[model samples]
Target chain A: MNKLRETLREAIVEAGVKDGMTISFHHHLRNGDYVLNMVLEEIAALGIHDLTVNASSIFDVHEPIIEHLKNKVVTGLEVNYMGGKVGRAITEGIMEKPVIFRSHGGRAGDMENGSSKVDVAFIAAPCADDMGNLSGKYGPSACGSMGYAFSDAMYADKVVAVTDHLEAYPLADVSIPEGYVDMVVCVDKIGEASRIVSGTTRITKDPVGLRIAYLAAQVVKHSGYLKDGFSFQTGAGGASLAVAKYVEEMMEKEHIQGSFCMGGITGYLVSMMKKGLFKTILDVQCFDMEAIESIRDNANHQEISATRYASPQAKSCAVDSLDVVILGATQVDLDFNVNVHTDSQGYIMGGSGGHCDTAAGSKLSIVVAPLIRARLPLIVDEVLCKSTPGETVDVIVTQRGIAVNPKRTELKELLVKAGLPVKEIKELKEIAEAITGVPQQVKPEGRVVAKVLYRDGVEIDTIKSVK
Target chain B: MKIVKNAVAGTLESSDIFIRVEPSEQLEIDIESVVKDQYYKAIYQAVDEVLKEFQVANGKFSINDRGALDCVIRARMETAVKRGGEC
Candidate 1:
């Protein structure tokens, strides 16, 4: 008995997609994703309306969704991150209901707890068999880890495998087994391979960014967390990437071996693992092609499910084992509340993917951002939206100074004792204000545009509409 | 105050606005922006505040905005108005 379908329409019919039902998609393909749009277009053509789309993330490539939202084809959106194009519309109060913004861990947990019930999950497999055995590590559109799709496949009532490349039966290296998937359909092209790793994944060459990175690495080294068996995670931002580089150098200089490096894995982390800096890489997603290739070939590079990666409901997740995690912030308030959800102008551009989860789970959560961006201060009295609560945040590193959370008194003392330029968070705010001047607060107008959820599924903050 | 010659301020950066002011019979503001669809009113409000502060009665102000914050927009308009009034 074959589970393969001739067309996506047939698979959609077989998956029992109906109006007002929730459908899901993962962003492993990132901006290169075609499955979400393809599936939605088909659904729209079939006269389906009021469908809620539960995607892991939405990128600029998914701008076609603006029309879908306008047409009432997709009335609700639940996501971890959103790019500015679609996000701008949401901020303009385009949808009737506010979008549900969840953290990566929160999304996985919500799916498992039945809070976010996905009726059908469309899995964009890079490689799959007739029986729906899938892997994102092969084929022309290989995207590396299928981590975010794991929960959807497991929890969704119907799972459909949409693939560009279909192999023979009983395919090896299965990321998701055949039992979970209900139907498999071959497509012409799932996504553009080049677009999968589009942004700058390299270390920053800018002096100011590098200085922040250098100081961040120093803070980590002296913070008492950088010993043998240390585990680390860093974002794909320029400064964060540079921090990873400097940390690797320090590890090599000290000859200290670490346990693991996790999060959206990059080639730099792969290089560190190769150089014996870390024993393994717990990769939930691959940031670049090198990481994709590494995960494909290297045994130390292990792909993990979203649940095992950072789900709060999980008994033991990789984030809980993390010693240090370097993250980026659009703005950080004096209380340490981070605003990754919106820009200083209250426009929705980003959201907490795993920002809150890793911060809460890790021993040291360091937020790295420049003091000023485009003539505006990065530190403010209050964040525009609280994407990650201040209590979970441990330290903030800026180009001008480093601010340790007051709760971490020992860490403050350690950094101060190490002769590091550790300053109070208020001082950092002052320094930023001095440079950019005390700007008028941007008051968002209109109704609520989105709800930012904490990793535990609590409504932490609400992003108001930008008028 | 009235504009005499064309004057421009600010760079066309991601978070900046470039304002071009020239002499006109009436206050005419033409804004071409990436964020004009969602933020035209806010941008107009920022321009109006700057114009009212400087008391510029009539000028053809062309704004090319790139998602600049209100403060930056005000500063840029202030600089351009000052320069435009000088000539």
Candidate 2:
């Protein structure tokens, strides 16, 4: 009988700790994540620096990571970080180097292509059996889906499952299989599921949000694309979900039978699927209890891998099949280039995870947002950084009006001629500048903090978060 | 004037819901006034019954719906009436 060491420190030494090695972590825990900190503190204690960290996503809880960067214990950074403490700090020019940001699909594609090779992947499995079979479901800290970790387990050179609860043998229905794992370490707690799933994906309460939703739906309805056999996807935000709601009403009124609704499945979508509004739901991950329950019960709620969701080379990616993809933007520029990456000051708050992919693949990409938020203009002369290229953004819809990309002159003409509430993107930009007086410039020290890579595996622009 | 009556006390009152009593004479309703959500009609139904319970009559009442689905809407409106007041 073979025996394996159980301590994280022991596991680290046994896994072959070196000066320079690639380490990966998953960000399913969101803002309240703690796995990254626990593991990094130990890694830093070992004086092992100059390492590449592949996180599925980074959250505000990862603020301690800044210490790692400052101490030279960590060098390269990678993950999808939304606007929060860590993201803002990094964007504020805290990190000395630019980060490598990838969309959810992009990260998965990287693993498949051997580009993002991980030396060791530390998975914080919420629940695990003695032999290393694990799951994020059925545990106190269930985050619903193991979609993000699925890639790390497949591609990483060594897989370690750090978990709080270790079940007895006969671990059936595995979330992370025993085959891919090399060792297991037990901890007091993996995370709080309440916190992981705590962030409410509710629609906006603001009247302006309702207005934008109404206008965005009107744009779709007027574009004459509100027809049968169409397909769509939207993020799980107030504006995005509202777009879906408004669009749903239009489709029902027009008797339009959509082919499918894809990506991050939510209860709102499950209800629509239940209503037979769409024929299928190609779900990559579930966002709420209803979505998880729907996956458990409904045959149509198909579980999809990242590669199948948006690989440029896939035989048929779900994103490619999208007739329209409603995306959220932090800000947009006159060139129509949109930035979901950095903040107004060009900090790496988030990246293109599937944003660019979907925008590029979808037939019509609409960026639905308010013209001004907290009195800050959302439309600027030049985007702080380019995450989703303007070429793919067909329509920019706000509560005030809608602007079609000039490159998409056909769409511009169609929307304009159809009497859709239309305006030039410049008009929105000017209004914002007029209100905010061209917005004070964000000065970021000229050292790349993250690389914004295009789909062809080429570097487009390097982001320097403001210092 | 229509009046809404019979409502659940404290528990349901504090939530994002309401009840109403319409005496009659009201067109369908304004979509703009309705809050965007998965089930906005819930707010509408709740308000309708509260008015019926009170036997209040002859005025228009508007509802600002959030996410209260049909069932939730009906529940909230009727519940809001115990501490009755006019909208």
Candidate 3:
């Protein structure tokens, strides 16, 4: 054990991670994680300099991380999504190394295949024994599943556990075994579970959101998809769930029925199964109580793992056979390129969790989003950061109008030919820029912060933070 | 986006994946399509089975095909109906 400890530190020193080695972080935190900032401060106290911080994903709570990047103490980054002020600084082209982004599975695959290796992994365990048996269930900051942390802990060269409540020796209910752990540190608290949930997972009650839900239903209806025994997947958000409700009513009215609902299983999704719309629910991860209960008791409600969820290598990945996927976007460009990466100003706070996979595999991938955000347009000339390429995105639904990929000129022509509210993308961009006033200049430093990875596991783009 | 609420009933159209509906009523749907090329057909068959089971008139319905297999379609549609009551 002593040798292992000494070897880890020695490896860090030998690997040229002296004061400014590029360090990496992973976001299983959603918004409640504090490990990144806390570890960075501790590293800084050790006199680390010129450090580049790379995380799987960054969130709004991580705004303070940008200050490290600007200080030259932290010099690089690699994350899935960029939002808020940090993204703006990067879009202005402030950083040099283009930020890199990747799909969630792709990131895991890369790390597994040794493409993206980490020097140290700072994982926050909700429940971990002193000897390093870690699970997210026991800790005060339990976030249910540690699905995101699996890769980091397994692949990182040096794995460190930061937790507040350490259990007895030989920790029970461990997701990350002690065999991979290098060190254990106890803190007063990891973070607040409420903060971890950041955005409300509830379905939307707003009239506009409800209106969009209705519109989305119409598109599905007119698309010639409405029928008994249909299969589909929507996000777990309010609008997505609300669409299920509206569609349920339609089923009753039409006397139509359906079969299965797949993907991230939530309570809402479970309700659908229980009501007999679907004969069963194929779930990978349960998002709430109803889902958990359903998984435990309902034979129709099943649980799946990440590999079965979208893994190309799986016998039959859930995504490969999707018919239609409804999604959300931060911005949709004219080329049909979608940006869930950075905001108008260029900060990253999101990740590509099967976004590209579903878009690429689904028969019809529909992105439902308002045309503008905070008075700024959601459609831009060029994405501040490209998470999902335009090629994969089929339909872009804005509050003002909807646009289809020109590649599907037939679909575009069909929609326009249908006389639906369709308009040229340029008109939408101009209207947005008109109100936002031609967005101010954003400067990015000449350093790569993150990388964008295609569903096929190819590097797409690299992002840099502004100086 | 739309005013009336008919699509959710699952009578609107059929696909392997999704079903359609409007928001006039609490947004509820019983999507039964599967992740298969014949997902629409599968959903159609599953709905027939559900109606036989529930004894409701084949009722108005909308579907959003997702390319699911027959078993998967039956599962989703049943789940959709079970939960459709809440919303």
* lDDT per residue as tens, model 3, A1-467: 43122223343443345564556665655567787777776666556776666676677777776666666566677665555556665555555555667775566666666777777777777777767777665567665456556667777777777777777877645667888876777777787667654343677877767877776766666565668767778888888887777777776678766767776556776777767777777664445545545665666665444445665544566677676678888877788888776544455556577788778877778888876554346776777667788888888776666677778776776676666776677877776566434543343444665677875678776555534
Model 1, A1-467: lDDT tens per residue?
87989999999988889989999999999999999999999999999999999999999999999999999999999999999999999999999989999999999999988888999999999999999999999999999999999999999999999999999988889999999999999999999999987554767898999999999999999999999999999988788889998998899899999999999988889999999999999999998988999999999899999999999888888899999999989999889999998987898998899999999999999999888776568888889899999999999998898999999999999999999999998998888766545666677967998988888888998999877
DockQ order, best first, reads 1, 2, 3
* Candidate 3 segments whose C-alpha is farther than 4 A from its true place: A1-24, A50-52, A71-73, A88-96, A167-174, A177-184, A198-200, A222-231, A248-267, A273-308, A311-316, A345-353, A372-384, A406-451, A461-467, B1-87
Q: Candidates 1 and 3: which is better by lDDT? A: 1
**TM-score for each candidate, following the candidate numbering:** 0.90, 0.78, 0.67
lDDT of 3 by residue, B7-81 (tens): 332222222344443333333335533222213343466656754554433234466554333454455555544
Evaluated at residue A413, the lDDT of candidate 1 is: 96
Candidate 2 or 1, higher lDDT: 1
Q: Can you tell me the CAPRI class of model 3?
A: incorrect
- Lowest lDDT sum, 10 consecutive residues, model 1 chain A, at A432-441
lDDT of 3: 0.64
Best by TM-score: 1
Q: Highest lDDT among the candidates is held by which one?
A: 1
